[model samples]
Every structure is written in C-alpha cells, then in structure tokens.
Target: MTRRILLFGATGYTGGLVARALLERGEVPVLVGRDRAALDRRAAEIRPSDPPYTMVLDVHDVGTLRRTISADDVIVTTVGPFHSHGRTVAEAAAEAGASYIDSAGEPPFIRWTFEKLGTRAANRGARILPGFGNEYVTGQLAGAWALERAAEMGVPHRLEIGYFSTGGSLCSLSRGTIASLAGSSLERSYTYRNGIRAERPGARSSSFRIGGRKYSGFSIGTTEHLTLPEVSPSLQELDVYLGWFGKASPLLATASLAGPLIRRLPGAKRVVSTVGARLGGFGKDGPESHERDRSGVLVSARVFSKSKHKLSEITLAGPNGYELTASLMAWAATVESHASTRSVHRRTGVLGAIQAYGLGVVRDTCLHLDVREVESAVVSA
Candidate 1:
C-alpha cells in the first residue's frame, strides 16, 4: 500500500479550495468525489504533480470507499454537514486502518467522532481526527497556547477554555454551510461536562460588548466544547460560542423554538431549510482574501488555575473561514504524510490538532493566522 492522502469531496467549494492549496504547495492527494468530470477538471487545474487517482462515491458510500484506500493512506474529507455524512467515512477509515481527518465543525458529529468512533478507529489501528480545520483548530491553538503558558507557571492546575468567534460582517457562507447549521440546530449540542461528554440541549446564548462591537453569541454546535478538554485534560470547563452571527440572534432564537418541531416534522424542516440554500453559497459568492481579512475571528482563550488565578490569556485572529479550513486540511495532510509510519500508528483514534501536531507546529504552519499572547508581543510561531 502506497503512502498518500485520499481527499474526499474534492469537487465541492471548500474542497476545491483545499485542492488548490495542496497543489500550490507542490503536493497532491488522490481526489475523491461523486463527480468524475469535476474531479478530473480539478486535477487538471492543479499544477503538475503525481497523476491524481480519483474516486467517485456518495458521502455514505463506505463499501466503495474501502476499495479506494489503503492502510498507508490518510483520508481528508470536506463533504459535510458532518452529522449526516461523517460517520460512514470515519467507519471505513477505521476498518481499513487508514488515518482520517475532516473539516467537521458540528458539535454533535464531532462528539460522535471522539466518543463513539474513537474506540472504533483505535481498534483497527487508525488515527482519526475531526475539526482539524476552521471550525476548531484556531480555538484549539488559543487553548493550547494558554496551557503552554500555564505549564510555564510550574503548578498543578484546573483551567478553562472559552471559544468565541468575534466578527464576520462581510463574511457569508455557502448553502451547504447554512444547510448544515440548520440541520445541526435540531441535533443536541454536546460538551465535556464534569469530565464527561454531555448533551447541551436548547440554544445557549452569550452577550458581551467588546472592542466597540456588541456580540450576541449563539452556540450553534462546535467540536471545541468537546475536543479542547481532551487537549488539556485539566481544563474543568469549556464554553464554545459564536458571536459572529451578530444581528442573527432573533432568527436563531426562532430556530431554537422550532428545534423540537424540526426533529419531529420533516416537512416543517424542509420549509425552514430553504433559507439555508438561499442564504448560503447557493447564488451568492464567498468573500475574497481582502474581505476576509477585514472580517476574521478573534479566538480569545483565558487560562486560569484551580485557585481561580488568571494565569495567562491567549488571543488569535484567524484567516477567513474558507481559506483557514483549506489551509488546515492541507497542512495537516502534509504533516501526516511527512511523519514516520510509527509516529502515525502511535496516534490511533480521534484526536484534535493540538494532540495530533502540537501547538508549535499548529502555530508555525498556519502562518496566515495572526496570533498574540499576553506579555509575548506578536510572535510568528
């Protein structure tokens, strides 16, 4: 079995961006998707590299997916609303002992990966990671930074990692993203409560006025609430919030009210979900680099000790969502590829970016994100 990466959903919007980033960096992955022509065109568009091996299959087509990968290969998937489509790919990768990574953000699905799929992947000698992209990595970096700073304190500690995305006025998402959020609205948001994975039902809200901007935060389901605890096991509490929604609180509140119905009535959900397709990447274009720069997330994490001491604070302004996701998947894939087989084999089971690559590499490799730590000034890595 040859060592390589099988990039699933290479034809989708975020997937295409990952493909280009990979190609631009003089790397290649076996592009996988349901559309053969689109995959071929994408392969052709990339710079000269190893002839791409393409696989066409639906997100749930695990039987066929198994035949396309090997133990030495790693699967990087972008085909999501992960709650609906992530399990199959994860299962197939675990069964085959093929390493796996995904751009999954939905908390329900991410919790499913770490709690349910972690053992499965490990049993088969595979290393699986969810939320390796925009949805969680930036937050993970902030958390990891705090932990490292506290480690510098040289004391026993119980800490907390709070994740919130600050701004995105010019930011917009694809129909796919909107649809995912709409679907996840019905699924129970999850977190590690009292050192255990627990379901956080209903919508959790946050209100804060910072940097001359008012934030009405929405807990729209994210993996960070779960994964960050594993990264820093001493972390006693974790809250993941979304202030980037800005004025959309009323609409989200309505969704919260309708969540019970969405779970029970399929038709009602269908009608509401049309908003996702309309508002997402359907007809509207995504933001460009400059536009994204003007509107990126401020991932702020405060580090505290068991005695309620504020040890240190970590802050990072990540790149645009789409670009951040693409860069992360590409960079993680590249890191896994260059790593020794023994190193990979030792990393079996679901892991976060901090656990998989460490904060040093995450900060170093994701150069596009600007990071600032307390008393540290602006450091590149």
Candidate 2:
C-alpha cells in the first residue's frame, strides 16, 4: 500500500494551516473531516498540483475512523478539547497501528495518552505522539537540550521549564484551545517529583529572567513531566510553567489553591467550563495573520545539580504559538511518512517530542522554523 498522510479536522483553523504548510512542502495530504464543503473550500484555497483527496467521516464514529486509517498512514489531528473529542480518534490510530500526532495540551488527556494508550500502541507497533504542537514541544526540546548539557557537569536533579509569549492578546488563541483550557481548569494536574505526582494547577509559581526582564509563570502539568526524566535519570523533580497570564499569574495561583474545594462543589466543573468558554471567545476564528505575526514565544529550560545549584540553561525563541504548532505538525508528519527516518528511530507508543525525533533532529527543525536557541549557559561550581 502506498503510504499517505491524513489531515483530520482539516477544516479547522490549525488544520488548515497544517494543510497549507504540507502543500508548500510539495506533499499532498488527504483532508479528512466531517464537513465536505469545508474540506473542499480548504483544498481549493491551497490548490495543490494534485487534486487533494478528501475523506468525509465523523471522527466520533469509531468503526469508520478505524477503517479509514491504515498501518501505512500518518494521521495528524487538530480536533480537540481533547479530553472530550480526542480519545476516539486516538484509539483508532493506536488500534490501527498508524502513526498519530495531535495538538493536545490538556494535562489529563496527555496523561491518558501515555499511561493508558502507551502500552496498547506499543503492542501494535503504533507511534502515538501527543502535544506535537507549541503547547509542549517547544518546552520539550528546550528541556532535552538542557539535560544534555547538564549531564556533562554532573547528575542533574531538577528540571524547570517556563513558557512565555509576547505581543499577543488572548484573542490569539483558537476556540479549541480556549475550550480545552476551560475544560481542564478544574482538573488535577501532575508533575514529576521522584515520580509522577498529583498537583493542583497553579499551585506553584516560578519566575525566570530572560533578556534582563523578569517573567513569572504558574506551574502546570506538561509532557515534560513525563518525558524529560527519561533524558536524565538523576532528575528528581520537574516543573513546567506558563507565563501567559503575566501579572494575573499570582491571582490565578491563589485561586488554584482552592481547586480541591471548588472542584467538589456541585456542578462546579460544568459551571467553570461554560464561563471560561464564553469569556475566552470560544466562537471566534482566533487572531489574523498579522496578529499572529506580531507574536513570539520564548521557552527556557534550566537543569540543576543534586546540591540544588543550577548547572545549565537553554532558551529558545520562536514564532507565534499557532503558526509554530502548524509548522511543527507538518514537519513531524512529513518525517514520519518517510520509512527511512522511521526506521532509524523505530520508536513506538506514546512519545515525547524528543523521543519521537531525537534531540538533534528536533533542534535542527526548530532552527529551520526560526525557533533558534537564543541562549545557552553552563555554570561552574
């Protein structure tokens, strides 16, 4: 069978961007979605030299979804608020033994991908990669690079990653992202301390100094908690933070301390989900090209020695989150489609960005996407 790339949710905002990116690279991905008209419109907009094949099927229909995917196909999905809509598609890919990629950032969904689906996918020889987007991939690469450098000094015990963005407002986020955040706001997140441990979102706060300015972020669960430790065995603790809220981060952190109580309130989850969605502009089309272009992202990863002294730090600066996400998914899908590259790594099951593609390749890809390393420091004892 001829290997093909399948773009699910191709009619959505990020999916459309991924489609365009793939076409620009001279690859024609089959657009798969429930709406034929939207898919047709997207295909027309891209105007690939070859008439792009389109598949119309409800992703919720597990039977059809499984049938549609093949072992030889690479599936890129952007349909999310993943905790709600992502499982069916992900399961189909795992069962079909197809290479799967998604833009999920929800902590619970990510955990489920690794803890529940990891073994099943591995058994089937499927490579399941969650958070192959800006939400976590950028930080994962940064953390991996830091771990590599810190290993030279001595065994590292702690890894901390911070994500910051500039020149963009909340309007830059897609409806899907907003909804995902809303859905997961009250859920318990995890971190790596000795091992995976439950933690309240925003329960901890961290600050980083970059370019001589201070940025503060609230702690959150990320793929880094699961993947970074594998890069360095001596790691005893890992924390990932998001500084997008800026001055509001402390307020958010304070509110999060009551998470356990608030979550227990009758109907609290539904209430928060609804309010968050509306407040976040869940019905909008997200920011325009100019707005996205006006934004940039910075990710910092710092590794510390057993004695609690910082050993190494790596920082990467990149384009807007959405744009980089689309580009990264496209680049990853292309790489997975090639048999030679797949064989070289031969990685199966749920994987972190570094595990899916080695640190060298991820670093090179970041450079190509203008996500160059802006700083690297190795401190002496």
Candidate 3:
C-alpha cells in the first residue's frame, strides 16, 4: 500500500499554514474539509506550481469519513476546539485503520482520547495521538530527553516542565485556541503528583529565570501529566505549566478557586464565550511572519533523581508555536506513513509523542530548535 498524507481542516489558520508548509517542503497532500470553495482556493494557492487533490466532505458524515481514510494513510487535523468536533474524526480514522494526529491542545480532549479511545484504537490497531501541537509536544519531548540524560547519572523520578509563551505585544493566537479556552474555561485539570493523579485547588504558577531573563508563568491544562507518567516509568510527579492566555491567565486561578460558582453565575459563560470569540475571531489571521518570527516557546526543565539529587537542567527553545506545531505534526505524518509495524510497539497503547515516535527521532527532527542540557550542581539549601 502506498503511504498517503491527508490533511483535514485545510482552510483554517493552523491547517492552512500546515498545508502551505507541506507544499513548501515539496509535498503534495490530499486536503479535506467542509468548504469546497475554500478548499479549492487553498489547494490552488498551495499548489500553484502543481495541480492538487482535495475532498469536500462534512466531518459529521462518519461513514464517508471512514471510507475516505485508508490503512496506509495518516491524517493531521486542526479543526478544533477538539473536545466537541474532534471525536467523530478520531472515530472515523480509527475505524478506517488510519493513524491519526491532531493540533488539539485541550486537556479534556486529550484525556478523552487516552482514557476513552486509546484502548479502542489499540483494538483496531490504529494509532491515534493528540496534543502533538505546540501546547504539550515541546514539553513532552523536553521531559523525555531530560529523563534520558538524567538516567545516565541516576534514575529520575520527577519531571518539571515550564511553558511560558512570550512576545512583546505582537503575540497572536488562533481563534480555535481561544475557542478551546472558552469551551472548557471552568474545567479542572489533573497533574501527576507524588506518583498519583491529583488536582490541586488552583492553577499552579511560578517564576523562572532562563538565559538571564525572568518570566512569569502559570499552569495550563494539558494531557502531559496523564500521558507522561506512562512513558516515564520512574516518574513520581509531573507538572506542565503554560501561559497562553496572555493577560487573561489569572482567570485560570480564579476559576480554579470558584469555578463551580462562577460557571453557575449569570452571563459568566456568555462573557467568556464573547471574549474568546473576539480574541480568536474578527478577521484575525494567525500569527504573521513578523509575529511568528517574534513568537517563541521557552521551555525549561529540572529533572530529579529518586535519590533527591538534581540530575539535569534542560531548555528547549523554539520558533513560532503554530508554525512549529504544523511542522511537528507534518513531520509525524511523514514518519508514521512509512513506519513499519516492527518499528512501532503496539503495547504502549496509542502512545505519547515520544513513545509513538522514538525520543531520538523527535529530537533529530527538531534539530532546528535548540535543546541544551547541562548537569546540575547540587546547591545546599
């Protein structure tokens, strides 16, 4: 069977970028989406140098979707707030035996896939993984790499991840991302704590100084805590912190403190929905070249051994989150398309980014991004 790379939601902000990037990299992908006109226009734009193939089909049509996908194909999607619209696509992909990946950064959606669909996908011999976007992929890959480095010295037990997106004013985020926040505003998140899955009362926040610059960061909902523990056998704790909401980040703590009450209050839901709509909408384009150039993800990690020794300090610096996300997702698609059964261990059950593709592959693919690791020097406290 020939390996085919299929892309869904090709007209959206991230998906369009992914499609364009694919073309720029000399790849011709099969574009699928609900809008025939838009898909046609996008396909023409992406492949002006060549003809293109596209499918105009509603994702809600499960049978059609299933038939559209093939066992030797891979699908990368960006049409989300995934918790609501994502499951159907995932279902169809799994049913068709197509390996799947998405730009879903929401915790609820990611957890749903693992807790609810991981086994089913495994049963069908399908590989479906989520949160392969800028949200957690960077952290997951960083943590996995750090753990490997730490193991050379000693067995690592805890993985601490800090994701703080910073750009001066030109920071542009997608409407889908903002829509995701609005959809699950009051949702509580579980962090891997002391070898147990648990939730604290409020979103955790912290300050970090990397490269002589201090930044404020807070925890955001991600599936890393749930997925990482399975990959990191010796891991006793996992904390993934992010600051994507920009000025609205404090609301994470606010909701954590009184989410039930606030969610029940009048106009609160409408208010969040309205703001997210504006932030994610209003003729808003995804980050422009200048904006993307300025945009970056600064992820730092500290890995500790079970012996209470700090084993390593690692930093992963990368370019524009959305662009990088598209790059990473496209790379995964290429890798999975040609991946043989012998290369994949089905027992891991769908697998995290590091598990689905080996840590080495991820690191190598992301070589354009900087990953620096240094041995930790014990500081007497």
Candidate 4:
C-alpha cells in the first residue's frame, strides 16, 4: 500500500496555509473537510500542478472517519477548539494505526491526547503528535536543548519557558484561535511540579528580557509541562508563560486569581464562555497577509539547578506564529509519512518534536523555517 498524506480542515485559515506549504514541497495532500464548496475554493486558490483531490467528511462521523484511514497513511488536522472537536479524529487515527499530527494548543486537550489516547495509539502502532505548531513546539525544542546542557549538573532542575510575539496583536488571531482561547479559558489547566498538578491559566506572572527589553507573561499550561520530564528525569518543575498580552499581563493575572471562586459559582463557566464567544465575533476572518508579515515570534527556555542557580538559557526567534505553524505541521507530516522507510526507528506514541525527529532534525527544520537560536548562555559552577 502506498502511503499518503491527508489534511483535515483544509479550508480553514491555518489549514490552507499548511496545504500551500505542502504543495511547495511537491507533496499534494488529499484535502479533507465537510464543506465541499470551501474545499473546492481552497484547491482553486492553491492551484497545485495536478488537479487536487478532495474528500468531504464530517469529523463527527467517527465510524466513517475510522474506515477512511489506512495504516500507512498520515493524518494532519487543524480542526480544533480541540477539547470539543479533536477527540473523534485523534481516536480514529489511533484506531486505524495511522500517524497523526494536529495544530492543538488547548492545554486540557493536549493532556487528554497524551494521557488518554497515548496508550491506545502506541498499542495500535500510531504515532500521535499534538501541539505540533507554534503553540508549543518551539518551546519544546528550546527546552530540550537546555535540558541536554543541564544534564551534567546531576540534580533536579526547574524549566521556565516564555512565549512572546514581537509584532502581533489579538487582532491578528484567527476566529478559530479566538474561539479556542475562549473555550480553553473556562477549562482546567495543569503544570508539572514534581508531577502534574491542576492550575489556572494566568495564575502566575513572570518576565523575560529580549533585545534588552523586559516583557511580562502570565503562566499557562503547555505540552512542555508534560513532555519535558520524559526528556530528562531530573526535571522537577516546569512553567510555560505567554506574553502576548504585553502590558496587560498583570491584569490577566489579577483576573485569574478569581478563577477558583468563579468556577464554583453556578453556571459561571457557561456565562463566561458565552460572553467570550460573543466578544470574539467568531464569524470574522483573521488578519490580512500584510499583518501576518508584520509579526514575529520569540520563545525562551531557562533551566535552573536544584540549588537555585541558573544553569542555562536558550532563546529562539521565528517567523509569525501562523506561518511557522504551517511550515512545522507540513514538515512533521512529511517526516512521519517517510518514517517507515527511514533508517532511524520512529517511536509510536504521543511525542514531542525532539522525541519524534531527534534534536538535530528539529534544529535543521526550524532553521529552514527561519526559526533560529537568537541567544544562548551557560553558567559555570
């Protein structure tokens, strides 16, 4: 059986970008989505050399989805707010023993993908990798590098990662991204403090200095909290923060302080979700191409020894999040599609980029995407 790549949600903003990136690499993925007209429009827009093939399938139809996948196929999905719509597609991929990748940033959904679906996928020979996009992959790569350098310390370490956007704003976010954030705000998040523990988004606030300027970020759950420990057992605590709010970082932290109390109120979660959705105006599209071109991404990772001394710090600078996400997802899908015939053995399970492709491959791929190491420093004993 010839292995193929299938892209689900091919008509959405991020999905279309992924399709274009794949086409640029000479691999035309079979576009899969429920909207035939939209898929046709997307295919027309990209204009691949060969007439692109498309399949109309509702993600809710689990049985049909499972039946449509093959053991040797690769599935890349961008249909998200994943806590609600992702399980079916992920489960189907796992059941069919197909390699799966998704543009998921929701912390709860990511955890579920690892803890719940991981065993099943591994048992079925499926390599499931969620949060493959800008949401966490860059941080994962930086953290992996820092951990590698910190290994010689021979003591438990704490990892701190901060995500910052130098030229983007909330206006640049897509409707799907807005909805995901709104829905995720009402869900429980976690952090790794010796072990996984429940935590609220924005519960903690910290800062990072880039280009000699300090920027504040609020804590949020990210896949790094779950995958970094597996990379190095000496990891004792992990914290991931997002500085997109810029100066409003402290305000978000103050609001999060009320999360525990608000969550206990009758119907508070529903009310908040409803208000957020309305405020986001889900029907609108994301920023225009020029706006995206104006944006850039920065991810920083710091490792600290148990004795309260900083071991090393690494920072990566990259293209806009959406653009980088498209390239990253396309690269991951291509790698997975060829894994069976490659010399290196591919592990089947929920994995980070380093676990799936190794550090050198990830570094090279990021470099190709213009995501490079902008800063690095190691402290001596």
Candidate that scores best on lDDT: 2
Tens-digit per-residue lDDT, 1-381, candidate 2: 336999998988889899988887778899999888988888887784556889998878988988888789899999877887899999999998899999998899999999999999998889999999887999999999999999899889999999888777677777767777877878989989999998888878989888777778999898999888888888999999988766777788887878788889999988877776676644676778988989888899999987899999988888999899999998888877875424645989999989987899999999999998874342100
Tens digit per residue, CA lDDT, model 4, 29-116:
9999999999888888898455589999999998899789978799999997788789999999988889899999888899998899
lDDT of 3 by residue, 241-262 (tens): 6655445555565656666667
lDDT against the true structure, each candidate: 0.69, 0.86, 0.72, 0.84
Alpha-carbon TM-score of each model against the true structure: 0.85, 0.94, 0.88, 0.93
Model 1 alpha-carbon drift over 4 Å, by segment: 48-51, 150-167, 200-202, 207-214, 231-233, 249-255, 268-274, 288-290, 304-309, 367-381
Error of 4 at 248 (Å): 1.3
Error of 1 at 220 (Å): 4.7
lDDT of 1 by residue, 88-119 (tens): 88888878887788988777788788778888
Give the C-alpha miss distance for residue 51 in model 1, angstroms. Answer: 7.0
TM-score of decoy 2: 0.94
Cα error, residue 191 of model 3, in Å, equals 1.0
What value does the lDDT take at residue 329 in candidate 4? Answer: 94
Could you tell me the lDDT of residue 212 within candidate 4?
71
Listed per model in order, the count of residue pairs whose N, CA or C atoms clash below 3 Å is 4, 0, 1, 0
The residue-level lDDT of candidate 1 at 257 comes to 65
